[model samples]
Every structure is written in C-alpha cells, then in structure tokens.
Target: MNEQDDDRDGGCGAGCGCGTPGREQFVSISRPSDAPSTAGAGATDRHTIEQAVIPAGTFVMGDSSGDRNAGDGEVPLHEVTLGSFSIDATSVTNDDFARFVDATGYATEAETFGFSAVFHLALAAPEEDILGQPPGTPWWFGVKGADWRHPGGRNSSLAGLGDHPVVHVSWNDVQAYCDWAGRRLPTEAEWEYAARGGLDQKKYPWGDEEPDAGGTWRANIWQGGFPGTNTLEDGYLTTAPVRTFEPNGYGLWQPIGNVWEWCADWFDPNYYRASPAANPTGPIRGGSRILRGGSYLCHISYCNRYRNSARSQNTPDSSMGNAGFRTVSR
Candidate 1:
C-alpha cells in the first residue's frame, strides 16, 4: 500500500488530475460516420460488437513459471474460477471510438486538457520545440494537440490507422465509451482468463513460444532498442493494426502484445493473496486502476509484462500513446 500512488481517479488526462478545463464546449462538434468507411480495406473484418465467450473454469493466475524477472505483483500464483462471460475479441479501434465520439460529441479527457502524453519518438521535433515531459519517464512527452484523432501530435492523423487501436484515451474515456456501447470494462480476473485463451499457465498468448519463432514476427513491440530508436523489425514503429497477429485459443487477437488495456478494478500489489476463489474484483479502492498486457513499447530490456499474469497500474484518467481498452459483457 506504500507504493507510488496510482492515479485511480480524480484527475484529467494521464497524470495526477491537473490540467485544462471547459469540457462542456465539446457539444458543438457534430457526429460523423464510422471512420470514413475505408478504415480496414482488405484487412480482417469483425463485428464491432463481436465477442468470445470465456467459459466458467478454474485457472492458475500469476507467475508460476519461475521467471526471476517477474514483478512482485505477479507472485503467489493462485487459482480463480470465473463464470461464463463474453469479451470483445480485439481492443476498441479508431473506427469504433469514432462512432462514439460522433454520436455523443464527447471530447476525450486529452482533448479537454488540450494535451496528452506522446511517445518521445512521436514528436521528432527539436527538443526545445517540445512543450514538456513527464517527471518519471522523459520518453513520454506532453505534446500539444495530441488526442485520439492526432495520436502523435497536431500534425498526425488517423487516416490509414483507423483499424489500429485508439490510443491517447484515458481510463475515464474508455468507461464512457463502454457505457455508451452498453458494455463494461473486464475485471482483472476476467481479462486474464480471456487472455490465457484456454491455455493454462502459459506465458504470452500462445504457450511458451517466443514472439519471433521460425523467423515469423509475432506481436508489435520495440525491436532494436528502447527510448532511443526502434529498428521496427516487427513491422511497426508504434501500433500495428488490430488482428495483425493470430488469435489465441479463445479467438482473441494480440492478447499479449498491443496497447495496454484498462481493467475494471483498483490495483493492489497484495490483492492476489486474498483474491476470491470464485471471482475476484480486486481492491475496493486504490491509488490506480489496473492495466493488463504490454504495449508496442514493451521490450525484454524494460517492461516485458505481456504475459497472462503480468500486470501494471495507472491513474484512471491517464491516457498514453500505448494505452487503450476493450469491453466485456456478463
């Protein structure tokens, strides 16, 4: 409980809840179509509401694999039984979010705050030109005009990236989107259950297999280096289109490597010890909400938490270039 206070609530875009105001003005924006109709041409087509049913079963949770690198939060591998529930097979895409934004004229927390965190590489501007950087990670720059539409900054666009997961979305933004869609964020247990994809106690979405096996690149992750340069050996400098890789046993796409998805629970490092045997919903209150799976930025040298048991935390309103969410239904 003495860890760095997680940003569970009471803030704006991606920080300790301090930023710009005047969100009511967003109502002036008119609704638009579902992302220009060409978001995913010749790409995998799936219903926006399509979901896979995760059957009721008991599965081992956390790091039982003896990975010395695993964090303390992943320890004491326990068992959890969850009832039948359904979840979106993929992270919410730009097109999906576009419909929500158009319908409600909802300005994301980032837009309301007038800025959001962008991967430092995204700026490509002279160091002096960048406005500022977060205290913890300088790699995360606070770039002006960065939101869901312009993920990089003022100049970027979601043109061909419509099929990609919508980033620069705060936890609050995802909650509103889920409510409008008549869906809910998955609990940490449910998320890990679905993420395991019927495979019990395995690292990554597919058994213990390495991401790049047989010279076939798997998930989209930093290839060459972290914070400085990326060789893009995995065919992406940042996010790749949803369904870019094969699905897991439960027909889930990119379960391990993609934008970190928000979970419906307050994060506690010690929660697993007392987690329910039937269905655990995490702590009643905490500093931060839970984030699962790794992102395009995850690498072995830094954050390698792309496994079924790996977990991370962030403030409820925190939005990042590598953060996104999915939804579930009872």
Candidate 2:
C-alpha cells in the first residue's frame, strides 16, 4: 500500500482499547497543584524550565497492555531501570521557543525548508493554492509560510499562544534548544519512564481508566471526527495550554497527549529485544528519532499513540505543526 501523508497504521475508523490501534477519550483538564512548579528553572546563561524529579527506579517498559490497539514495535514487554532525573513539567512552549530564537537569532527547519506540512483543515487558502498533499494522505497539505511562528499558515500569528507548546519544530531544532537551554531531551527510556508517572503497566498517566471516562475530555485530541471534522469536544481545535491538564503522579503535566514530544534517541522498532536492562538510549544510529505521546491530530479512527508506550518518529530534519519537545537535566 502506498503511504499517504495522513494515512495511519490502520485505515480510518479503527478503534482499540486492548492494546490494539484505535481511539479513546475524558474530563475538563485542571492543574492539580497551585504551588509554583520547578518545571522551567534554568542554570544561568541558559534557559531552564521547571522540572519534576523522577527518582531512579525500574519499571516494566514496553507493551504489556494487552491492548489490541498496540503495534508490533511496542511488544515484548520488558523491564527497564532508569536513574532518577528531572524533566520539564510540560513540553516546551511557544514563548519558550521564542526566547531561544530571540537569544540566538535562530531559524527553524520549517523556515530553512521554506515550507512544512499542514493539516488541510487548518488551511484557509483557495484549493488550488495548496502546494500538494502527500500520496494516500489527503488530509495533510503542503502549506507555505507555515512555521512555528505562523502555525496555521501565513495569516496565523503567535499573539496569544505564548503558553502553547511550540510546534513545527524538528528534532534538530530541539537539539539546538537543549544546547542553549543547558538541558537535554529525555532518552526514550527516560521519557516513557517519566510519562508513566510511577504507574506500573498502565496505558495512560492516570491509569487504565478510559481517556474520557467522565463527561470531560482529558487530553487534547480529535473528538467527534478525525480529519474531516473536529467536534472540539475537548474545547480546542489545535494545541491546548501546556499547563491545562493535571499532573501525573510525579508532578509532570500532560504526559500522554498534546503535542508529540521528541526524545533524544534514534528510533528502532525492534530495539526492545536487545535493549539494555537499564537506561537504553535507543539505536546507536538511525534514520529517525522517536516521538512520544500523541497529538491533537490523533483520533480513534486513526492513530492512538496517545496511550503510554505508544510511539512514533520522524526524520531529524522533519518539522510539523504537531511536533514539540521537553527537556531533562542530570
């Protein structure tokens, strides 16, 4: 089957809860703590985000959810012990990225490439003006002038989204931010460990409960429909405020869904079989880097990596409106 830009691993309208590929939902997100968080603190001459400390420990990593929705890459459940470390309470935000750009006069990969892929619905252009959509994925279009600053298109702006996680950022772009911020992206193991929020074998940060068990929309995801229509049942059409959701057990915010977060390791689907018992950094070298958590684009009809342990990847230079990252420190 030819790959389409928006084509998911499964065709449209698929659902999974038993570790199979599908969709799930939740309630109005609220911050659990009003205490000033240490998530974004920095270490002088570099930007620092308040971070939550994840103590050193071992947890069952990889797929054991028995989730019929899970993919082959997440299989072969294994134990992974990770050292305690601190991670940003949430993914890096627009204001955060703006600071990086302003301090270094940096240009993002989208700017360098002169274009990036955009969700078709986010576009307001005449149909003919769309550069193109990748084969098979008709929902994604090549929209010019769609960078981090102008996420939707040329007409979009960052005026009120300073607190939103920065998108249209590639893995390469995140590396630069880490360098300047004096922090590093979480290793794949660390990311999963942190995201689990001290839970053992749960599909989401909050446990096995369905994402939308109550009347509330827990994470920001496509509600009513996938590509064609977003019912906004979650009260957001795109990114939600990074601090919108309650913290996981470890005081980290919104670990399961929002924007896909970049990890430091290169991606390898079968790496788990040979991965280290402790602190696996991923493949020594690979074509793409890992992205964890799902984005607003995820839905039951398509991708559902929003669950814990579900993962995706992109080339080091690939940037998209749904991509972002967070940081961890030694």
How many residue pairs clash per model?
5, 37
Per-residue lDDT for 1-330 in model 2, tens only? 111112225432211211111001111122233321123434534655687989999998875555423243675678888888889998899998888887777777667665666677777545644566555465676666778998888878888999999988878788888877778899988998998888988988889887788887678877876668788878888889999868899987888767888899987767877888988899999877788887888776655678788777767777777778899884
Q: List ranges where model 2 is wrong by over 4 Å.
A: 1-45, 68-72, 124-129
Tens digits of lDDT, candidate 1, 153-179: 888889899889998887778877776
| CA error at residue 254 for candidate 2, angstroms | 1.3
Compared with the true structure, all predictions reach lDDT values of 0.72, 0.73
Question: How many Å off is the CA of 13 in candidate 1?
Answer: 20
Give the 10-residue window scoring lowest on summed lDDT in candidate 1.
16-25
Candidate 1 wrongly placed segments (more than 4 Å): 1-47, 68-72, 124-129
TM-score of model 2 (CA atoms): 0.85
